[model samples]
Structure formats: structure tokens, C-alpha cells
Target: MSKETRLREEIVTVGRSLHMRGLSPGSSGNISARLDDGWLLTPTNACLGELDPGDIAKLDWEGNHLAGKPASKEAFLHHAVYAGREDSGAIVHLHCTHSAAVSCLDCLDPHSALPPLTPYFVMRVGRLPLVPYHRPGDPRLGEAISGLVGKHSAVLLANHGPLVSGKTLEAAGYAIEELEETAKLFLLLRQQPVRLLDEEQIEELRQTFGAQW
Candidate 1:
């Protein structure tokens, strides 16, 4: 199979996993992987649970459709991240339940959306900033994401959802999963007196595993 074919199949597999695990539902998430010439993105309004690999949209670096179904309206989200973060090979944007719930909360830190609760969250998701609200499919949201892309691989959109980028499609997949689970834990423990990973411990993780924090 060609590289593009492999990526399409992988995107389908990952999307299906997200849907099955309740991380993506309805037509609420979009995914994309970088290609040599462009990108392979899930089609607009397509259910992540039922993605057809052959119908995955292909687009150039400039976000123009090249083949397959029409690209997700959030194509510019992928475009912005890839342009800003050369290391990102895949992007996953989702309205998973817990992450979306966190987005709706009013008091989250704009610079760091989630507190460091788990070491894996710190390692996989790093620093997750929360982007300001924008209506679905709004192209202007890309500019906000791009502005927050310096060291962050993930961001939670206010009243929206989370967008994550990683070095590979699988990496992005894993990171988003971690984000979702961590978000869930954050909500569950929100009322309790929780001992978060302190700066010293977080520093150890950064020194030992290169955690993003």
C-alpha cells in the first residue's frame, strides 16, 4: 500500500477507536495526518465511528482539496498547527465529553487548560492551553491555535473541545486519549483537596522523560 493509503487506514482505525471508547461521538471529531505532498483528513460531518478510508479527503499544504471527499471545515486547524509545529505529523480535534465539559467551565487558566494530575498527562499532552471560544468551522480559530503553538501540542477550545497534535498519527491519538481521561479525572476530583504534581515533581518528569508540562 502507498504511504497515503497507510495513513488513511490508520486514521480510520484511530477514529473508530475514539468512537468506540466514547472519545468521539456523532460527527463531532476530525482527524488528519501529514502526507509527503499534503494531508489526509477525515471528511466533513463524517462520523468518526464510520469513516471510510477510501473517502478520506486529501489536501495540499495550502488547505486546498486534492482528492477524496471534501476536507473537514476545520482543515485550517490542521493547517495552522502543521505550519507552526514542524514536528507534528497528525492532528486530532474532538468534542469528547469530559474535555468539552471542561471547556465550558468559566475559570480555567487560559495558558494551561488542565492541571498536571497524572505523569502521563504531563508527558503526552504537555502544556494544554485553552483557546477562546469560536463557532464550529470558524477559520479564524486557526489563528488562535497558531498563536498558542509555540510549545503546546494541545489546546482546549472554550465552549468547544480539544485539539491535539503529535509526532505521528498514533502519537496524536494517544495524547488525545490521555487528555480526555485526565480531563475526566480533573472533574471528578474538582471538589476534593487534591495534591497535584508539584513543581519539583514536574521538573523531575521533565528531566527524566522530557515531559511537556
Candidate 2:
């Protein structure tokens, strides 16, 4: 198979995995992977569990549709991240229940976001910013992500979902899953007065993993 063909298959495979794992339901997520000439993305309103490789949409770097099915309505957000972050090769956004529930709470810190619940989270996700709420497909949502593209690998859209980007689609999906797991842990442990990792431990993990900000 050609590179584009392989990417399309991979996107569909990952999309099914996300849906099956309950990261997204009822077409509530979107995914995209950069291509040599452009990009391949999941179709709009399509159930991720049933995606076909041939139906993945193609778009130019400037967000122009090049071929295949209509792209996800929220494609602009992915484009914004890719445009601003040169290292980004794939992006995934999921309406995972735990993460979305956490986003609704006003307590999330905008700066040092996504508490360092575990060393893996600190190493993979780093700080996950909480972007202010915006209606789905609102152009302003893309604008908001554009500001944090270079700094954050993942962000929680307030009351909506989490968006994550990485050097590959698998890496992006893994990071988003980590975000959801961390959010679930946070919610579960919030009432127990748990002792989080100290700054020294966090720094040690960061140094050991060479975590990028």
C-alpha cells in the first residue's frame, strides 16, 4: 500500500480502538495524521468504530479539501495546531467521559494544568491546559489552541473534550488516553485527600525522561 493508504488504514484502526475503548462515542471524536503532500483525517459525523480507510478526508496544509469525504467539522482545530507546531505529525481529539467531566469543573489550573498524578503522565503529557469553552466547530476554538500549540502537547476543551498532538498518530492517541486516565484518577481520589508527588519527584521524573515542555 502507498504511504497515504497506510495512513488512512492506521487512522481508521486507531479510531476503532478509541471508540471500542470508550474514549469516544457516537461520533464524538476526530483524528488526523499528516501526509507528505497533505493530511488524512476522519470523516465528519462518522462513527469512529465504523470508519473506512477510503472515506478518510484529505486536505492541504492550508485546510483546503483535496479529496476523499468531507473532513471533520473540527478539522480547523487540528490544522491550527499543525500550523503552529512544526513537530506535530498527528492530532487526536476525544470526548472521553472522565476528561470531559474534569473540564467542566472550574478548579482546573490554567497554568500548571493536569496535576502530576503519575510519573508517566508527567513524562508523556506534561501540563495539559484547559482552554475556555467554545461551541463545537467555532473558529475561535482553533484560535485558542493556536496560542498553546508550541507549548502544550495536550489541552482540555472546557466542557467539551481533550485535544492531543504528537509526532505520530499512535503517540497522540496514547497521550490522550493518559490524559483520560489521569482525569479519572483525579476525580476518584479528590475526596480522599491524597498526597500528590512533590516537586522534587516531579523534577526527577522530568529529568529522567527528558520531557519536553
Candidate 3:
């Protein structure tokens, strides 16, 4: 199969895996992968659980639709990240339950990293910044993401969900899964005295594993 065809199949596989675990519901998420000439994205309003490899959309870096199907309306967010991070090979944006719930809370620190609750959470997903609320498809959301994505591999969209980029689609998916689970843990422990990983430990993970923050 051609490289494009292989990417399509990979997207479908990952989408199915996420949907099966309820990370993506209805048509509420989009996945994209970088390509030589452009990038591939899930079609608009397409359910992650039922994506067809042939129906995935491809668009140039400038956001022009090249083939397949109508691109997701939030394609610009993916484009913005790609423009800033050359190492990001795939991105996954999802309205995951726990992460979206955390996004709605007013306690989030807009400028700081998400609380480092667990070792894997810190290792898989490094510093996660919160983007100020913007209407879906607003260019400003893309701008907010672009401003931070260079330094941070992930950002949580206020009142929406999490946008995560990785060196590969599988890596992106794993990071988001870790993020969502961490959000769940935070909610569960909000009333208790929570212990976070110290700065020293986080730095160790960064130096040891090349963790992004």
C-alpha cells in the first residue's frame, strides 16, 4: 500500500481503539497525521467509532482540502500545531469525559502545567496548559494553541477538551489517555489532601526520558 493508504488505515485503527474505550463519543473528536505534501484528518461529523479509511480527509498545510472528504471544522488547530512543532507527527483532539469535565472547572490555572498527579501522567504527558475559552472553530483557539504547542505538546481547551500532539498517532493517543485518567484522579481526590510529584522528580523524568513540558 501507498504511504497515504497506510496512514489512513492507521488512523482508522486508532480511532476505533479510542472510541471503543469511550474516549471519543458521538462525533465529538478528530484525529490528524502529518504527511509529506499535507496532512490527513478525520471527516467533519464523522464518528470516531465508525471512521472509514477511505473517507479521511487530506489538506495542505495552508488548510486547503485536497481530497477524501470534508475536513473537520477545527482543522486549523491541527495546522497551527504542525506549523510550530516539526516533530509532531500526529494530533488527537477529543471531548473526553474526565478531561472535558476538568476543563469546565474554574480552578484551572491558565498559565501553569496540569497537576502532576501520577508518575506515568507526568512521563506520558508533560506540562499541559489551559487555553482560554473560545467558540469552536474560532481562529483564536488555534492561535492560543499555537502559542503554547511549541513549548508544550498538549493544551486543554477551556470548556471543551484536550488537544495533544505526539511523534506518532499512537503516542498522541497514549498521552491523551493518560491526561484524561489524571483528570479523573484529580476529581476523585479533590476533597482529600493530594500529594503531587515534586519538582525534582519531574526534572528527573524530563532528563531521563526526554519528557516534553
Screening candidate 2 with a backbone cut-off below 3 angstroms (N, C-alpha, C), the clashing residue pairs are: none
Candidate 3 lDDT score at position 192: 98
Clashes of each: 0, 0, 0
lDDT against the true structure, per candidate, is 0.91, 0.88, 0.91
Q: Candidate 3: RMSD over Cα atoms?
A: 1.0
Clashes of 2: 0
Which of 1 and 2 is the better model by TM-score? 1
Q: Tens digits of per-residue lDDT for model 3 on 56-164?
A: 9999977788999999999999999999999999999999999999999998788753698888988888888999999998988888788898888899999999999
Tens digits of lDDT, candidate 1, 1-213 = 999989999999999999998888899899999989998999999999999998999998877888999988888988999999999999999999999999999989888989989999999998889898888879899898888886799999999999999999999999999999999999999879998899999999999999878
Arranged by lDDT, best first: 1, 3, 2
lDDT of 2 by residue, 73-143 (tens): 99999999888888999999999999999988987898655688788788888888889899998999999
Q: What does the lDDT come to for candidate 1?
A: 0.91
The better-scoring model by lDDT among 2 and 3 is 3
Off by over 4 Å in 1: none
